[model samples]
Target: MVLEENKTSSKAPVGEFNSSDLEVGGVVVYRDRAEVKRMIRVSVKKGENDVVVNQLPSVVDPKSLRVEGEGDAIITDVIYQSKTNYDEKTKGDKKQYDKLQDEIKELVEKEKFLTFKLEVITKQRTILNKFAEQICKFSDSSKEEKADMSEILKSGSVDGVMGFLTAYQDKMSHLDEQWRMHDREKTTLTEQLNVLRKNAQDLNPTTVKDAKTNRCVCISLEAASDTDVVLALSYVVSNASWTPQYDLRVFSNDKTMKVFYYGLIKQSTGEDWLDAKLSLSTANPSIGGSVPELGVQLLKFKQPVVVSKSKRTSHRINYDELMLCSSAIGGGLQEYDPTIEDSCLEELEQKSTGKAIAPIEITTTQVETNWTSVAFNIPRMATIPSDNTEHKVTVTSVGLKPEFEYAIIPRMSSHTYLQAVVKNTSSYALLSGPANVFLDNNFVAKSSLKDVSPSEEFHCSLGVDPSIRLTTIPVKVLRGQSGLISKSVTVDYRHMFEVKNTKQEQVKVTLSEQLPLSTDERIKVHLNDPDVRKVNTPVNLPFGTVTLNSSNNLDWVVNIPTNTTQPITLTYSVEYPPGHVVQGLPKN
Candidate 1:
């Protein structure tokens, strides 16, 4: 953001205002808004001096403005207003706008020429590739067709055909190189046009009937003597936010994990924060300050209310379309160019994970905790443009020793998933957000993290592991008649699950299963096999322990030895009177 200053007498015309040169000092970004602080030094006479801070972003909240400073002056009043002017540009601004327009025209023409050249090159390359393909198929054709297509075949012998292919490959390569060069030049031209257009737009912004509007803060104070006073102003602005993203790197050998916390900050507040101190907060100012109150409840007869449908037209511009226009005019985000190379993130996974790794430059943040929210203050200055794009910053990183285990629900899926349980040891709190999980420096899966305070434990799924195999056998059902007087029917159900651990180390696995719960009094359901008649109690088995809850859900925690196979069986029976039907009973 640029600021201009002009000094005038206190008795100047009513419409004219004295402005000060303000510089952005720092910013505190929250969930939906940011608090910006600006500072300025002003020389005031002994009498009353009105100082105006000009060129503040229009998105600022007028009610959130605050002014604080220490000097031998008595601060009286402060006012914030949206100022509008007609024909505000001077001769110099007009000259610069014309220059930018000329530059833009030149760049656009060059871009058009480059695009046309690239298209020609692409067509030539395609033709060359097709010719090479047809020439290679010449030898495979029959003699009758070869004689008919002899003119199409450039060479007679295999070696001659090979020579033609090699030459074609060279020509195609050269065409491809030329295409790339022209494409890069076109991209460069587009960027130059964007910059020039942005400059032109800044000089002549869109307004209502040629009127330019901006925000300014006015301060009224009385100085004891002629002196220079430093003024600090702060305000809240919207269209700024930060979201949390985490990278969890798991070291399989050490059974440890390192969490690289990052905050993706985005802002379109109409001012760039260049070399400004930035702090990210977890607070949401949009929710308001006071607590919500509940209204009195009333009940009455229901009545239908008729809603009239009326057609209304909106004058607001679509944001996506505006962004496209801005990109074309060099005032918005750049277009996606496929000619540019991708990031080096793919190099993280190679043939060998033991290769030498490059040291990453990591930035640390200072944690500031409060009763309502936690803030991460970046230690260094940052430059963030007002482009509304994601700017990732490293918040902090912590290493944790995690407990590993395998979990499976054979009824749902036969694949066993590896799980990691870790505690948040750092003082900072982990907010709920998306995370990327990497095992042994290779990306495994994308997961989400819940809100975890300091010293709180959390679980992360590390995806399926094939080494721990699980198999589900067909369920067995048996039915028979019992109770001679009533002739009741008894149905028996059995479930068998097999697990084989091929890993060299012993592993612990948790298997979950469920039993049917009876809702009627006459229909009785109970576990017959491996039944201890105890609910909410873990019964010890030879391989593991199984616990049954009131909901008829069973959880078995088993520790399997290396290279060993274990079989788990569960049986339950449902009994009902003759001629009575059970809806969910298993069939043989």
Candidate 2:
């Protein structure tokens, strides 16, 4: 006989499970559907013993008894209470175990997914850190890179790693566009700030207009004449945010007189205003009179007068019939007005009080002119009549003016005349007779004069020889009783002289004694050589030695020897007596 049994197994589906056997309470179990379908299977070909059933004693527990059959048998518990207790305990415990196992499996799977997400996030964080580090390094390299880094960093977002990256890219693009738009604005604002700072530095604290202060101006005018007029006007400014450029309009009644525009204060130093003037012919003749009384008005501004692309304003000052006067009364007034004098004094006092002080005064005088006369004694040159050799006649004076303008006139012969006008006044009077003249120690001519005045005239005559010689005429004048008079003028004279070669072979002469000398010394020199003739003294020698020339009548001849290397010695002496020393020295 075959017996059937029902079985239950707690395992996964066959395909889902890895193993078919299972252990429960130290018992290994196989998962098989055939075993579960049948409780026993019998084989009939094999011999099997028959089983007899007997009544068990009441002392044996029926729950512990079991039976073995030749074919598998299904055992049924007779003790239902005990089976029911076992089933209840097993079912409760198994259900709890299965629940715990399912919970652990689910937790493990969740942990694996979390770990994968952590890895991805960590990797992304590392890339971001590296990118930030590279950006920092590049910024530190140069100014250009620093600017680029600023742009990049400004675009970064504070989101999750990948989201932050995408946001950062989008932000970077947006930031680049903003920079292009705002760059010009930012530059303009910066330049304006700099210009404001510079202007503040250059400006002074105290100015014509202040935001938090009040100001006042005082004007005063003085009238010189009754017709002179004066007028003034003023205006009040309020709530001026900036020192605005404005155009001021001036009017007379309803007529527009002038317009003035205020310039930039930064380029200007003072307050800008327009001043005008008008004349009054009559006080009140008619409303539309030809010459009307002067009227004045002012128009202030509250808005800026913008001068585009221009630095200076075009406003100009208008001056109407403005007349300047000096006198107070007219020419028709006859006598001096006492009231006018008092008014003038009062005006002067007021002006003096308003101004500075004046300086002190000192006295002065003029000079007077004094006059004197002068005379000179001239020497006359002797002429040689015998030999056909022409002789030079010269008249020289010692005390005469060295430089004087003179007109020489020959009273004897008007045809062969000589005239010299003495422009220079001297301290001595003129001589009476003819006088000899010598120039550069040579005979020149003779001159004679009767008298000489302040701008007097003198006369002289001369004969010139063939030889040319340089000569200067000298004159001697007497000392006057008056003070010394010096005059600078040109000396004019008609005279000529002959020059002869006096130098010959060297001559040696000896002198015994020195001769008496005078200021005007006339002498004749003779030489031992036949070719040598008489000649005047070459120069004025001092009254000391006689070794330079051989004295012959207070004179000496100088000559040079031909083909002779030896030098010639001339012995001469001079004796100058003490003469009257003229107080005034003659001016040359």
Candidate 3:
């Protein structure tokens, strides 16, 4: 990575000066910290040379700094120190910021003036309208040939009154036109002011310490002979990261789901990663080394740990401290533990920002992802700014065959839900992320995906399915009366469920219904039906054993053939002592 040739100047009595040979060549963005790799190209003379790379981020962890070169030179020491470049730039930007503030003030004052002008015009128009209405009334009453003389002479003769009204009418018309012009101008100015304000906000550095001074790492080299030195310096930087994003487009007709893998990258580490090669990973240098610690532990039963009921907000806001996993300069360790909480507050955060980012067309080579933690080597050079905007990037796309089914819980909801059960066939671990679901190219709603390992099957709701019709009705009503045999009351109830599948494909349905339970012996409830039809669940599954819950509820996982109607009946009866009404019995 040869940046440029070496040059020396005697203007500042330069014995050891900063070199312009260093350039940010690549960046490996992780869940938190980003590893910035810089290339230093220098032509070394046959002597000891001291050169510094002045374009390093201030958030660079001191322990994560590394420098190595391939030339006739031995790397001695690398030091990170403060300089005046960043401070000087900050001072220049402050002046521009002040100028922008003045512009905003001027715009605000102009808006106020224009608003007041519109108010005055409005008042004048109102007064003219009232006078015109009175004139109309006088004209209407004069047909009697005997109008009120006092009203007629209020503004002198009739001609005089007419001329006064006419002149004021023109005046009001002109004022209305002026108001329209002023309103347009005010709107334009307000928009301009808003854009400038947004620019001002984006231009300001995120951290005061980073903006204060230039933090550069300098290295001294002892050259054995004259040669061109190729050096690579890599350091860990904060305030820059990437998280997973996904788009699931379901082709209902084709019975397939297209999953688009995306990356939401934000860089606020002060320096722009312009035209730098990018590699997004789940690696984190903060957790620990790559080597696993093996220790013996005994498992014993104890009191369960009480987890907090509150959401883990730190997963969205805070990051763990960076601890370097570097054993040496060039040779380092990678410990991957992605710390991103992607799906929880994505909608809320997006609403707060008031900005929209269009989805990127996901594309990547087949070799981009691998086992365990996936790595995406971006093919093209990227220029990511430091405004903390979520820049979208393409990763990969996969088409999956999913089994679509309709599920109903009549006890809970009257609506039927469409669920897709798909296997995650890709090698990449699908970190939990917010997903936008589309059915046949029409956007359905916003949903989320759970963390699923490769080859694991997971299901997500795709919202209500209107094609499948379902209805639940009571066939037999609950009745209780005292019997002669034993002064007890008995009630019988039956609930019937009918499902009509309209789809062309054969679908499996899962329906759950509950029955009343009796904890006390005197208030026992018995099911009237002798036996219920057994479900043809998979042989590998142990769904044949039906154990009603202690709550007296049981789930029925049934399969409904395509283009057909299926009716299921659940019958039960409750009996209690006379004068002791059964509470679980339905009124119907």
Against the unseen true structure, what C-alpha lDDT does each candidate score? Answer: 0.75, 0.26, 0.67
Tens-digit lDDT track for model 3 on 235-268? 8889998887787878766688878777889988
Top candidate (TM-score): 1
Per TM-score, what order, best first? 1, 3, 2
Per-residue lDDT of 1-588 in model 1, one digit per residue for the tens?
112223233443112232223566889999898998877677778868777766778787777888887777877777666756656454456667778888888778778777766765655555455545555665786776566455433223355445546576565666677778878888888888888888798765343256667677667778889888777788888999999888888988768898888778899988888788889998887889998999999999889998966321121223343233223222122232311122222224433767766645566688888889999998878877899998877787787999999999986898999999898888889989998888997779999999999999999999999999998889998889898687889988999989999999999999988888888989998787677577899999888899987777888899999999989888998899988778976656
Q: Which ten residues in a row have the lowest lDDT in candidate 1?
A: 338-347
Q: Which numbered prediction scores highest in lDDT against the true structure?
A: 1
Q: Using alpha carbons, what is the TM-score of model 1?
A: 0.66
Q: What lDDT is obtained when candidate 1 is compared to the true structure? A: 0.75
Which stretches in model 1 have alpha-carbon errors above 4 Å?
A: 1-21, 87-209, 294-361, 483-488, 519-522, 529-539, 549-552, 577-581, 585-588
TM per candidate comes to 0.66, 0.13, 0.56
lDDT of 2 by residue, 1-588 (tens): 211122222322111110111110111001110000001121221222112112222122222233322222222211111111224544454455555555555544544544444443343334444554554466345665556545544444223223544454554454345444445544554555455444443332322122122121111112232222111111211111111121111121232211111111111101211111101011111233366668888798789898677321121111110000001011021231100011110111124458734422211111122232111111221211212222221111112332211111112211211122233243323334344333322335554445444356453333332221222233222222221363222222222211122223232221121222233442112222122233332443332222223443322222214333222222222222233342222322
lDDT score at residue 539, model 3, on the 0-100 scale: 22
Tell me each candidate's RMSD, in Å, in order.
Answer: 21.3, 65.2, 23.1
